[model samples]
Target: MVQGRIEKLRFIAEEMQIAFHLATNLTDPFFARTIARHILVRAENLIAHARGLRRPLRDAGFDTNAFHTAKEAYATEFEEYFKVARHKIGAHVQDFDFGKRIELWNDIEIVKLSYFVDGAREIYEGLAALTVPGYVPYAVPAELSDPKIVEILHQIQRSLDARTWVEMGTDSLAMARGNTSAVLNTTPVHARAGQLALIRRWIALQLELRGKLAAYPAIARLFKERIVTDIVSFCDCLVTRPVAADALQAMDGLNKLVQAENQSSAAIDDFVAASHFETDLAATRRVRDKIGAHLEIDEAETLPMLLADLNAFDLDKALAFYDRVAAAFNKQCFAVLFLRMYAADGARLYGVTMGHSAVKPFAGVAEPPPAAPPALPLINDEQEYAKNLRRWLDGDENQKGTARDFFWKAFMGSDSIEDIKETEHFGSGTRYHSHQFRKAHQFLLDALSDGLSDFDFKGVLDLVMSCRGGAPYPLSEVLVRCAPHAPVFRQYLICHVLGEIGSEPHESVSDFFDAQAHSPTWAVRLEAVMARYKSFIKNEGVFRTNHKGQTKVEHDALVASMTQAMSPDERLICLLGFASVHTGPLAGVFTTPFNSNYTALQAELEMLILPLLNDDDANSKVAMLKQLIQTHDYVGVSVHIAINLNSGENHPLYAALVDACCRGTIIAASNNQASRHLAISYVMKKDHRFAFEIAGPLADRNPDWIDAQILVAQILGEIVGAEADARKRVSSIRSAYKLSPMQEAALAAVETEVQNRVTRQEE
Candidate 1:
């Protein structure tokens, strides 16, 4: 279902992109008009399909916040506009009132008007000749003509394209493991051969490493310290210090190699000079020696000054130089050379056979000893096999699967389970008891709760799959047991399996959700919230029937009591559940006994939840923001935060809110919820420069977006007026007008303060 929705969205986005291009780029009015008619139709389809993705995506345990945010932004900005255009102009033209101004220009002379025109006379004359002024059949609104609409359409398409890529990559991995025959049939023979060869080399490398490590521990330590640790630190630096610090760290590491009091140091120095990193190295040394390592009284450099000096240094080139030096050091000192391989090329190389026949034998090299075969376990009887299985289930996480493999090998002995059962040495009537299987299942579940490696998790999932159609276990009980601190994937899989089992509504499931509703992991909390909503809808008839005898006052009292009993986090979850039902697939189909509308329910919940934002708990504040995002009340919540910022009450809560909002906005550039709030907060603090810096780029990027222009204009008015830069103030207002001419009225209201400043200056 999720895949179908994703594909539908992809199809709609692609169609929208094509329609948008045709509508915008076509010169012929006929073609433009024809394509323009379908523009809103395609946009409406995209919106519906995009919204349709949320339920299925949530069901699959994927985060849909970004998708949800983008869809809401698109819909909030364009849904009504498109609806009106589609109804009045695009499709239902007869419903439109073109008004009294639609008339024929019967007395106008086209050639004379063109001769009097200042420029582009031929084009003007051509247009005048083609113009049919009487009762214009279809007039596209200026709102639909703005280029920002199409640009946003393109962004939506790009977002879907990225999502589809992720889905396809995930599908490929699952398909390769679950259906080898399908993969084999689909993959090219040469590619398969390369894959096989690469696997052979990998196995050979593992064997070689094991043999070498056992034979010589000293060399392995050298490899670990010199090669592995160095490379790991280098990679860590890349992630932890992506900007100036990365360049500084790379220089520091190179300096150690250069300053060593040995012959190799001289060689490394010469290599650095040869690589043209000498100047960068020298500058780094000066900064470190003069400012960092020792604070000389004569040195007047600050940290920012040092950073500025290193700003011109090419970190990429420096990193590359370091790589070359490391490789040379390895080859010279250890007689080994490293080579880089692209991932695709490496995967392809797996198919090649690593045999003497496949490669020419090297001269003057002795044949190495053959790798020893793996040891097998001694399982003399069923008791021993059972003991080994138990041991495997209780074994070290790192050594997982060892005893299981041994037990399975010894017990099966090239025979099926049925075959072994029939030949069971005078045990013809043997039968397994449910308690024994249940006990073993309990052991597996316990092992999972303790946490397993990915390999062990996969094995456990396989075992769970084998028991699917039999008597259903207390899987919800297991979920409750593991919900507190299990791995996220484990929690998700447990939830997935519970859904698959279709277990009856049980106390254990509800308990699991109630406990997990406040889980630290957002994904787990989201799953719990969604599950609660689904459970509510699934039992809607039962709930309604049970409450039929109660009056509205009694129902409201009962709901209030239940809500009062919940903690802040639980109330937030309850609020999210209400939102899901309100916006969900079955929205409007189900109603409360108290006859509360979605808006009232939402507002009531907000009244309960919003107060907790000032409760001196950062977690509570952050959870509120996340719920706001889910409820499509993020912007409003941010505005509330901005209002509070004016009061200057809670510093920690303000910081936490801003941080969460910033992270939320990372999902898409179009999501300026954080920036808008932050700018407002800064403006209230009287830091107009900071406000302008925060809101200016949003206005530039979304020039035609009225809200962004208004925000920037407000910030700029304060900033420019404070400085009393009259010319700059006038330019700012004019630029806003030029960028969003259709939004002149809105800009006028925002720019009124700037106009007042200009008027005072003129006086």
Candidate 2:
């Protein structure tokens, strides 16, 4: 029964955390899908362990502490796994962890109870194992495997609630680094090297035999071989004077290919003669005619068509085919003593394109040697390329005739795409013309101020980069796509990302970043903020009023947007954002954005918020408490809390703090940004207190709740402050968390007075 209950408890926890992300509006579905899958895997480990231990605790002399330690480790693993899971989920653990969160909005008392429940379970198991009937609870699993079990693992699910767990995931470190405790083993040196020199040498030698064939054409001509005669016949057939219909078609295609070459052929022919071969166009014509009849070459189509197909080789598809061919070669070569596996890769690409592989040695049919490789093409003269460039920039859609001509024109014209693909292009027609992003974006942007939608990321990106003139455009439209990391486009994309996340365009762009000004990455996160550093200082005084032109609804909308951005890494940025809320005057720095509240004391709030909430009655304490409550509205009496923490008495969230103590209700009655008032009521006996919650993307913001809690505690403490004999009084009212001697003494004194007063009243 206990085992089943524990299993059920695990399910509830896992699902609860998933639900919490929606509350902050930072739920990233991609991350959620990934984390949920991993949770299932880890849960299986716990189920496996439970299966191994059967017959319950009563049947064995079990050491429960050992199991408890393992379980504790398991819980730690859950927290660790959540570190990565949270990152994967697109938030940070600090933003979602329930333990930390409960401390913020709820109370530490609740987490304290959680600690108690965990401790009680451990103790009960050990004691029960030692003294009475038996059953041991399993580890707090970080993963859940079974679909049905996912519905039961509450702790495992809640384990992921830590906000950072969704953003920066914790790796499931092996209980220890891989096998350090085990004996060492090693492998062969050849395994480490990836390649064998002997294999390279063997392949090269086989190519050498083929390379020796380079003298074949000259030898055939010298001998007046059949190859020479066949070549003449083929040339004659192709050059027939009347220009047969097929011949006419061939001439036209040849004209286009040469035209497309745009005088590059002179350079190509010159390089070929100098680098790899000796050209004899008259002998070449004779050899070429005979080549068709001497060897079985495919000539069912015109020569240009065949050559074009050969040049447009698709390497990826070739490799795929080659894989199968390679396997076949090994199988064929295996039985031979000398296994020289044939690979046509290099020869098919750069060699003389002579591919006739016959296993049998030539008897009387011995072939002449092969010619050298084709001369690589190069554009030697910049001015010469101008002809093609003119054709490309001026050609009408109709004047572009022939596939080769169209392809050449389009390619040489594009600037950016041409750069990425390098100067060389197969043909102008290969690229998609209608998909031009520049024109598409101009059309879309003209139609809507927000820019295009329904386009993918690449499309939007291309349009932004191709803008005609220098100007800034709002990036909110693309924010949903290039989230978290700002898109890279001369840093303009960064501004868009910031604006999108910020959700409001400030009177000046500086205000947008200054808004998150408290983020850990604040001031540094967006360079634009620092860019306007001087300007901000100059106009600092008018900031509140500058942005004041925004309607209250708009201002509130902006604040909500800031909160959503901060929610993901609440711990990472909340302090930074809160601290920067009024972070103008910046103490002694050049005071451009002069903050009226800028005093050394307010600056010290950074130091105060990090430490205990109620610690300092120092100079800055008053500045911290200043905006917590405004008496004009009548809290009847006011309380305060910092948005920074749930502890500080001067917290900006005083309203929530007051509300938490009362009917536990917090109502932000007004939606107006400037005149907004949070009404709160905290009553103890016949007395009640009230306060308001001030909110914004303010750094280390003092939420009213944090101050409210501390305020109520102070009011409780002060009412009992006058008790006498403070130190030596209380020897009672003690249970846990050993109250110091002074607290005991003080409490004893207060208790005595209260009792005495009640007695007198009774008389």
Candidate 3:
């Protein structure tokens, strides 16, 4: 028979913990969607578990009053939080639709449903309030040191108030290093690596909070407000008379450092060249004022603002360049501080060099740059492009132009479409120009009507790269028409246009990748791999759905036209797509099989992929394994490794899987943990030492999971001889973990064994 109600509560707590880990740890939005759905399912299961516990607790309890009161309050509070989420968010109905409900208060509504920790905490609080024996379970430990970590973080902030910049920077760096000392002593390399990762996270936060903040308003604003005035004054002083000492320092620090090409004449020249400094300080100011510091301005507000101002690349480049400038300046300040610390004889050096007033900007500094020259166009090339575009748009001529001819002309006169789209105003030429590009888009599609036999594939790729804007098309019609063209060219169009194929009947992007990989040309095979990658990024490579269910007939026809051998890269990409699209454990009763119409195709692809696991090329195999790890495919990879193990094949693949497990590098969620445990069980019969390495990290992470704790205890007893220290470790687990009737009995059996071993050893 199953255990009592307390056991059920513990099981619910375990699920809640796993859900919280997956939701918080996995940061990628595409991967988080599946994790979020799993959390909601676990939350629903918790409600059922809570309800079942009430009847059992009342019948066995003498303290029913407190239990009853807490239950009623919790139920009332839960209904308020979960009313819309239970029906509208979790279900697809006519009036209360998931999409419509999400649009109302998107992040606020979704987070309440997805975050299980808060709900779990409320349940724990009520259980603690009850007075019945064993009814009030142990409080769950905070996820990796809650209040203590917060306290440590506050201490670090207090330390940041050091007098000088160097002192503050040194203190922050020391705290970052000191945080990882305990992780280094954990005894296992894998566990140490996982724990030490927090140091990098701490450093990244400091860089964002300390580094970026110091650079933005202080150094950036100063340069913007004073650079032109300082430079003009220095030039005027040089012509009319001699410069003052403060002016000389200002010119040496700001002007000479920025405009100097005499690399041998100064220390700053070498620093500037190595850092890739951009000389234009005025452009940097525009980006900061328009985008970073202000809120109300727009491209419409500043239409005559240079088109280059709107491109994100230009701003990003300018920001990066300014960061280097600030770092160089900050370094000079640190040097002065270091001199003052130890060199008593060099007090004069500090006094002369520490004149900060010269570098700092004043309120009166102001000037503007001279007017820029007008833009000129390639007249003949533009005329030809215009004629071809007009002809193709009007359907006036039977003569067709190549994508290369049209795209090359566009490139000479303009930047990438991304730059143009960002730079120009919607009311100005930007809107009209984007409309014209949409016409050019249709013209290119019409050019391919005759098929890709005469198409320069590279040229078409260049054109595809240039054609960017928010212009809608009938993508279903385009896909159907493009399907019969040359395999290479058709795959490129599919890769580029997959975003527009929403709810449209089309071939699976996977099928095209599998077919094109067999082509004689290497370029075609590379394009095929890239196309599958693009499709995976768009929506996990699932076939699109319509209101009338899947357009199954259209997809089947497209898959049936394939004939090619799969390259290694194609196999790797396809496996990644399959694993990402299919989640959950593979070992349980309700495991889902690969859902697809092409059974024979999938079987053939699997046959090709299995050999890769055993390849002699270590680099290639590791590369493939990295891709699997990145796509959250631990279960799928484990299943394949198990199949190979049964057949006594692929020794290298087995070694790789064991290394990954022992290193604790895989996603440490419930399904992934289950898969790793299963794999370790099979490996345990051969080598107990490797099994021990895997067991410690698993047990450490999942201290609340009774099964995991028991498993780790058993592994320790078998491999490490159940010494005094080992037995003590198991005893600690007994106290910390909430053991049920079954778990209590099982643990008692192990404890008896350990006691017998201790007596025999003493004798």
Candidate 4:
């Protein structure tokens, strides 16, 4: 389902691009009908899944959650179209039948629309035009053509593949009526003649291109550039003279002559919708006829006319044309809003895909990520950019003068006005180094009047600040100069710059209590404060982590340092973070964890958490305290593990919590739950040797270890428990410690009494 949406959105983008290019429509917002349907279809699928689950959940008493989820999803399933049904394109686009573009638009207000235009259009167009299957007569599988040519063919093929498609280029003309750029209607007589002419021209070009390709397939990239030459020529021809019916007739004759010439697939693709020419030419003609019926223009008027004069569209003509187009643009009614619809055509063209070639394309193959292009020249991007900005900031010597001169030049936009206002005080002689407040003020005024890229403005402010280190540059003036409207408000780099000098709503925030209120753009100012808030929020979280990391890193050193110099309790807390780092086995010296080494660490760990176990703060950390209690219950204080713990900083609070567990204090439990909640964590670390511990607590408790053991025994008397099974598992360790020196000494007096009782019972 996800894959389907991706493909559908891709198709929508392709359709939108072709429409935008054809109509030159920068004002209209193109929305894909296919994409909306896909989104709806996906919403429905979610609703269905939710509904299916709601029934079972209802039976189990969780139905309310399921029902609400399903109900909401169902409503959202179709609200997109219904919700956006107000604007001209928005309303019409929501309609099931409406297509991608409206007739008028250009570059001025176009936002996302411009993104769809490839910066590399020339490169791709160049590659596509000459993608002929058999250039010099020898033919292999059409797909086996040159790699670059194959890529080019894919680019053109995918453009017109959208559902509910409209025509563009020659296809539009062929159809005779459609939202089209230009069209060609091949009358039977024109067809024969044009085919012959096209064939002769096609053969000649093919032989030349093949020779070029054979000589250097790598450079074969140059031959296929889009028709820049053709467009320029046509524009010039149009400017040279007004069109007449006779001229139109002559143009028609010329098109007819070409129609007779080209039967080659490559030449066909060079025109619009060429990839589909083989199967859909006649169908295209039908669609064009439908569009023409509505446009009031005659079908014949849709065709592009050929011209003899190619140099007519010179500098003056081009300027005049732009002026007229610019005047037609109504800012209030329509603005070009750039649209960024990710077509991901390259990924689709190259990746494993589904559903294009009937059932075959849908075969079992997963999509692969698109290949990244080889390294193009990284080129002198920033350097050249900076130089251009320098020229803009400080007027070019040939055009104007220095930075001060450039400011006036930018504001006036004409040399005559600049000349009238020119003063030595505001020209090449002006220097920021003098710390002249008036000059700085003038510079700021000049900057505001003459528009500059964000980079240039930022550069100017930085340079000024550098010149006057201790000068009375107020915070208000500084911010007004650099962050005026706050476009880079959230950028930390900008924040850092501001911080170095000082600004509002920060450590020095009180100084500009009201300066921020007059912000031009709310979005930009809000982000500045948000950036500061985000910084503190981020660091506080980091502080706790650093604490743990530092604790871990210092653990080993602490343990060693305290070994002979400090008491056991003082050294124990320092080892907590390190002990937590590793939980598994180590080399041979100490055997199993049950060895005396563990008993020592276990004894020490108990002493650590014992003192604070009942403290209010420790109790407040119930979860951590509870785990500490459990660790003590199951593994006891592991002094063996404690000495080995190496501290590193990952989580300071985590290690700190462990420190509270091992050293802060001990918990005195009046009930079983209290004693069962310790945060002790222990594990076997020694190698194959008998590694383990002999457990005992160092401190006194409300219910001591012996007392707790008795309680377990009393509970056993009342009911059978895991004790019956636990005894068997502990038998080996219990036996080993059963007659130890400490045990024997304590049981010495009971030995005779136990023997007498057993003897009497046997009798």
RMSD of each: 31.9, 37.5, 32.4, 34.3
The sequence of per-residue lDDT tens digits that candidate 3 reaches over residues 515-594 is 66566754455445434433332332232322223332343343333222454443433343333333322212211222
lDDT winner: 1
Residue runs of model 4 more than 4 Å from their true location after superposition? 1-34, 38-372, 376-558, 561-570, 583-603, 612-626, 629-763
Error of 3 at 476 (Å): 24
lDDT of each: 0.40, 0.29, 0.39, 0.29
lDDT of 1 by residue, 343-409 (tens): 1222212112222111111122234533753244454444554565455556653233445444334
TM-score of each: 0.25, 0.18, 0.24, 0.16
Runs with alpha carbons beyond 4 Å of true place in candidate 2: 1-165, 168-714, 717-744, 753-763
TM-score of 4: 0.16
- What is candidate 4's lDDT per residue for 512-603, written digit by digit as tens? 32244234543223223333322322232243354542221122242353344434443453334223212212112212222333345545
TM-score attained by model 3 = 0.24
User: Candidate 1 at 720: error in angstroms?
Assistant: 29
Output the TM-score of candidate 1. Answer: 0.25
Number of the top TM-score candidate: 1
